[model samples]
Target: MEELAINGGPRIRLKELPSRRDIGSEEMKELVDVIWSGNLNRVGGTKVSAFEKEFAMLYGVKHGVASTSGTASIHVALGAINPEPCSEIITGPISDIGSIVPILWQNCIPVFADVDPETYGLDPEDVERKITDRTVAVIAIHLFGQCCDMDPLLKICREHGLYLIEDASQAHLAEYKGRLAGTMGDLGCFSLQQSKQMTCGDGGITITSNDELAERARLFADKAWPRGQAGDRGYLFLAMNYRMTELQGAVALAQLRKVQDIVARRRRVGDTLTKLLSEVEGVNPPKILPGVKHSYWLYPLTIDTGIIKATPEEFARAVSAEGIPASTGYIKRPLYMFSILKDQATYGSSHCPFDCPRYNRRIQYKEGDCPNAEKVLRELITIPVNEFYTDEDVNDIFRAISKVARYYRENPKA
Candidate 1:
């Protein structure tokens, strides 16, 4: 048997991975138009409005409300829903804080449901079990570029008459069954952060087909003031100034033109890696559901500790030593385990929605709130996936991972 790279042996890969993004003339052209126009704000500039129209058209939705960031996009959705205070918004435990923070800011309670052990998305059965009279909505966060089991979630929400919001921040252009990721729900939110498939440095958009919801979302994003109603300064209701600038829109518009191709290339790379990993023992690739298309935001894998005889951290370190980037446990803990949720840390010790008199219930977040989510995190090891990977690059990843796994198989007690 050969020595492992972590043990001072030769590495499997000698060069860094290829660049994932292709930002050049197309993006520059859009920016030049915005710069010469000299209107950076969306209200007066054509870029942001045009971007919204193009994005909405791409998703087959009637409206798209642009915002400053992914979190603000969620907030726009929440504002559009206009749920009563203390209303519960059920969502999965495995996602960015952006998915949960909006519920709190809207004076709503965030109820976490355990994720499916395989897909790592909100388990429909668990979601049903977590629902209550106070529940008004469900935020189906499509984690890691894969769609959740949307059929059951849609059925559950329909039967209960609750709003369904798709947090598709990591799942741009991902598909489930015959529908696109965001179109499956009442409203869909997306992030265009630098790392995402479509990027504008940092931005977001929410889409919906319902006329009322669309109008509310548009107004909500711009502080509830009716745009183009000259001489009227009436503020409609409580809302935020989460508007997207023309600069971000210009770049996003250009990125939008290439997003489908980018996602397709990433799918090829990710599918190739998954096929390769299947031959390696003990390590499990991301479990994609039937009839689902994963956009491959980040390639996540897990190890059977009993067979690998090593912790996720140790295995990731070994792979990284082979000149492949890898990390253990995506977020280190479930969202509920974080201080912002567990300690009820918000509103200057008031805890606001959680502690509000209208809520009238003793809500407590604890370690065992979502057992499946916690287990998945413990076993997860994340690796980078890029659209620009060549056949040789993909083979390098396979070689490094297979080499490390084989070393552990030979030295189970090491």
Candidate 2:
């Protein structure tokens, strides 16, 4: 193996984000104008109402309830289902903490399951194994902007009478087997954070086919008071304020119109990067499962530590040094790995149905607990595949990654 040296050091950048407002300046201005005219609440507002209607129609869902954020959307959706205390909600370990936090907040136990190595989504078999009489729901996260294998997951949920919640925060407009991601589950949640393909600076939406769920979601996000009920305007049920502002809704509505184009651009960049990465030694891009259209929120590539001289962390730092931004690992492991699980102040010590002390004390994870997820996390390096990257930028990233990979392969000592 021969090292590839660069005369001017590394050359690629990790992430070059696009301006959400840049893609839709005119529409964004219109939204700002609406906000300027004084309407910022979801209640009795045209922007909020229009956004909900348009978003629902786009996802092919019967109803959409806008919320403050993706976490709030999940919180409201989970609240609507109202699972019994200690009921198990199955989810993968690879997702953001927000997905599982809502389960804990709702007084439900989160059951960790392995993810498919190729898809990085919930493994139906693992989910089935984890299911028990106490299991009440399943949250299938569409990780990396690709929809999970929903057909089997849906079947598993249906057989066990489980509510399937689709966490589509990173997968807006992604499709699985011809159906949109959020529509396949009992309820779907979307994020409009700044980095997301569709953004409202900070906002989210929950869509569901069930009319009752939609209505309850609205109530849950709006201080638990039933909407449009006669007489009492005061809060009824105990609920947190997770309402979305009209301005956020307006920006989101405008952003939604360009979601398809944004997704397309990201896909193109991801495809280019994938092709380039495949040529590099010890690097493998994420595999696109059959019948899935990936929206490519983040193009993650795994570094084969056995074959490569450099560790994932080293590779990421080297990439960054070359001007490309890269990261080695994800946030803290599954919720079970968090200190909050042990603290009596949160969820209490004995709240876990399992051996609480043992669960909290044990740091070593089982081999198969989250096998694929663990493997990916250890070796994966992600580069942003946002709408901002141009063809030249993709080419630069490709050249830099290839040079680094070559360098590490030859210099086994370093």
* Top-lDDT candidate index: 1
Model number with the top TM-score? 1
Model 2 quality (TM-score): 0.90
- In the range 86-169, model 1's lDDT, one tens digit per residue, is 999999988889999999899899999999987898999999999999999999999889999999999999999999999999
User: Where in model 1 is the C-alpha error above 4 Å?
Assistant: none
Question: What are the Cα lDDT values of the candidates?
Answer: 0.91, 0.79
Model 2: number of backbone collisions? 8
Q: Candidate 2, clashing residue pairs?
A: 10-322, 12-323, 12-324, 13-323, 13-324, 13-325, 14-324, 14-325
The predictions' CA RMSDs to the true structure, in order, are 1.0, 3.5
For residues 70-132, write the lDDT of model 2, one tens digit per residue: 888899889889887667788888877788778878766677888887668888999999898
| Model 1 lowest lDDT segment of ten | 405-414
Please report, as a residue range, the 10-residue window in candidate 2 with the lowest summed lDDT: 358-367
